[model samples]
Target: MWHISEYDIDKAVIKLRHENADFRRRLKHEMLLPTDIENIICMASFGIIHLELQPQIIKCKKQ
Candidate 1:
């Protein structure tokens, strides 16, 4: 079974920050944004990464 604890989330973000160039670029843009756009991009990144890690969870709901 796939689990997504806080540790797993932190690890995934760290891994993506280092290994995924597109994610890293989006993260940079996300940080620079001063509005809800940052939240939108950040959520999108998490959604994409979550799907990559656990494709079986179609809705990507937290458990």
Candidate 2:
């Protein structure tokens, strides 16, 4: 499991809506599914320049 914020989800949804209002209106109001967000994250990650992704698992440590 990963820690994701409601604010982050809302921000993403708002961005999506701006990009395509009709598609956004068709979606129901509900919490974002993790898989949906994961897909979005994967797509966005590719947008980063010079970022490397390693295929390995790392446990999160709370500060």
Candidate 3:
């Protein structure tokens, strides 16, 4: 299973906001499985941060 953190999401969002070239490239290079991706989306939808978010970033690859 993969893990994703709020900080990771925050960083990703930040990179998105700033248009960070490297981060954007990285996010696009790898994607997470459906289960893990859904978990992160669900947490974000509810405005809750899961414990796992700190250790991993949401994968950019296809499910």
What pairs collide in candidate 1? none
Error of 2 at 1 (Å): 2.4
Off by over 4 Å in 3: 20-63
lDDT (C-alpha) at residue 24 in model 2: 57
TM-scores of all predicted structures: 0.40, 0.40, 0.30
Off by over 4 Å in 2: 28-63
Evaluated at residue 15, the lDDT of candidate 2 is 69
Off by over 4 Å in 1: 1-3, 31-63
Candidate 2, after superposition: displacement of residue 51 in Å? 21
Tens digits of per-residue lDDT, candidate 1, 1-63, equal: 534466655665667678867666756555322322333334445554322222221222234
C-alpha lDDT of residue 8 in model 2: 59
Model 2, C-alpha of 45: deviation from truth (Å): 9.5
Give the per-residue lDDT digits (tens) of candidate 3, residues 1-63: 545567766754554536655544554566443444444455554545444445455555355
Q: Compared with the true structure, what per-residue lDDT tens digits does model 2 show for residues 14-58? A: 666677554354344443344445534544444332324454433
